[model samples]
Target: MTDLSLYIHIPFCQRKCPYCDFNTYAGCEADYSRFIRALNQDILYEGHTRHHPRVPTLFLGGGTPTILKREQLDIIFEAVDHGFALLPHAEISSEANPGAVDQSRFETLRRLGVNRLSMGVQSFDEDELQFLGRIHSTGDAIRAMTLARKVGFENINLDLMFGMPQQTPAIFQHTLLRAIDLAPEHLSLYNLVVESGTPLATWVAKGQVSEPDPDLAADLYELACELLQQAGYHHYEISNWARGPLQYDGLPHYACHHNLVYWRNQSYLGLGPGAHSSVEPHRWSAVRPVGAYIKSVEEGVSARGYEERISKELAMAETMMLGLRLVEVGVDRQMFQKRFGLDAVDAYADELSSLQDRELVSIDAKRLRLTPRAKLLGNEVFAAFLPE
Candidate 1:
């Protein structure tokens, strides 16, 4: 069986970002103690039920993982340690906020064996940060990075966003340059997306802000590709870049192994409100409301709001779509055949031929991969593989 990865969601934030529609709440500190207890029970229940699967990668994501107090975080991790038999060299990672992390918080994280720290420093420009409703200023972001390094965090990832309203090429370049100067082990370049019902989306609808321009976003993405590549960072995925010593199978040493589990369409168990899990025969998503989720888990009833047995056809199609997201480690032909009892070549020959003709994909003896041009037109290419 493929090694199982784990995802733990933190559903609290200091202030919500306008563009974010994730299941996170602000001013819910009163529920912190109760939430942690429920989360612990959720993790323990799943761990025992799943037979203590060996976890290689664990991620703490959400509204703001750093919003929790040190004792709360310690309790959560203690539950995890007791429930799951983490591998000797697990990639323990957490997403942190710049304004939320202090010396004490940083030390607590390091002491808990959180080897990888991903800071959500969306921009290094104060004006851009304010426009995006980020609570952290440029100075705060810098101090956070410095403190993280001083606390002995060698592996760090910085997230940068571009292509917002009134954002010119120069403005983006300035932020990108500062990020490159800080030199985190990994970087994720994201374009501003206006998801429906988000504050940004509402602003765009009301003409308070303009929607992001695809053409401008494309230009910025290309610019990032040029600059990051020049700085010796490998564009491992469509939006992610990393630089370090070589890792197994030619991956960058700092590549996000936990996310790679999702990219590879492997099994993972998520524990938290609104978390999702994909195991061998089924895929399910837990209830989104924190109160309801806690009640369900505490009562020893199912917390899952939606569940479906995964069909072989759906799995194969998802394998092709998700595997193609890895720029370098595309769908392996041998592994596909071994898992599904049929070669991907034989299964998707028609779709592959069409994609190759359009110059969107390439199929070699070992793997089927998306071409460089397919990065921009990825949705269209991936859609071709879906059963009609």
Candidate 2:
């Protein structure tokens, strides 16, 4: 089996954000000990069952992974090391909240072999921060990153949210400038997305708060592109930038390796409630409820809520769609041919031609990629390859 990335979901949160719709929950403090046990069991189960697949990267994501105490986090790492053999230079990343974290917290993280820190700073504007329901203030974010550096975290990524209500070009620019000034190794600039079932969606439905302006969102995205490029950051992927010209495996040295596994349509294993896994051909998601996931694992049953085997045609279409997200490094034509026995050019000739006619994509002997215009209308370009 191919070496795969590991995504471990930590579902506890200090409090739920109104605009958030992830599988995380609040008031689960009581379930923490139990869930931690179950999580480790789930990890062991996969390792034993899969004969200890080699792990290239591990991403600890959640409502707030930083919410856990250092000791709890330590045990989780021990479980991982025992269950799976992580490559020595593996990218071990953990998402952290900027609030309520002291220098000691980051030191513990380093001791646990978490080399990369992804801080969810969200926004620098206090009003926007309040609206987003983030636990940290702008000052808190800065302090956390500074402390992280003090404790020797060299690979750091700051996550910022843009396109909020009442946000303007000037306001978003300040946030970008501040983030750039910090000089983190990586940055993820994401637009606010209002998923259904979230309070933000309900607010939009009731007209309590106006919907996020698409035009404004696009403008902010453009502004970020310009500002980041000038600041010496490589626009590696949509919504992600990293200080580069530095190379890791011939890609951006600071680019998220775990996410690259997904972008490249490679195999991965997701452990914990509400996590999804794709081992090519087969894909599955663990059940969402904490108790249910714990019980299933305790009883030695698969915690999967649903599973499916995707068709090759569908997988090809998906490969094209996901590959284009890497703004700088689009799909590799030769690699595609090696994997599927058909060059992407020939496999989707008609679709490629149609997209080219629309000036949304460009294809060449070595690679196939979206045009600059297509970067803004990526969904439109991606939709062309759907298995219909």
TM-score (all chains, Cα) for each model? 0.98, 0.98
Candidate 1 lDDT by residue in tens digits, 1-388? 4578999999999998999989998889899999999999989888887788899999999978999999999988998888888899999999999989998999999999999999999998888899999999999999999999999999999999999888888988898899999999999988899999998998999999988899999998888989999999998888899998777676898999999988888899988999999997799999999999999988989999999998899999999999898887789999999999999999998999999999999989999988998888888988988987
lDDT winner: 1
lDDT of 2 by residue, 9-44 (tens): 999889898999999999889999899999988898
TM-score for candidate 1, please give it.
0.98
Q: How far is candidate 2 from the true structure (C-alpha RMSD, Å)?
A: 1.1
Q: Mark the regions of model 2 whose C-alpha exceeds 4 Å error after superposition.
A: 246-250
lDDT of each: 0.91, 0.90
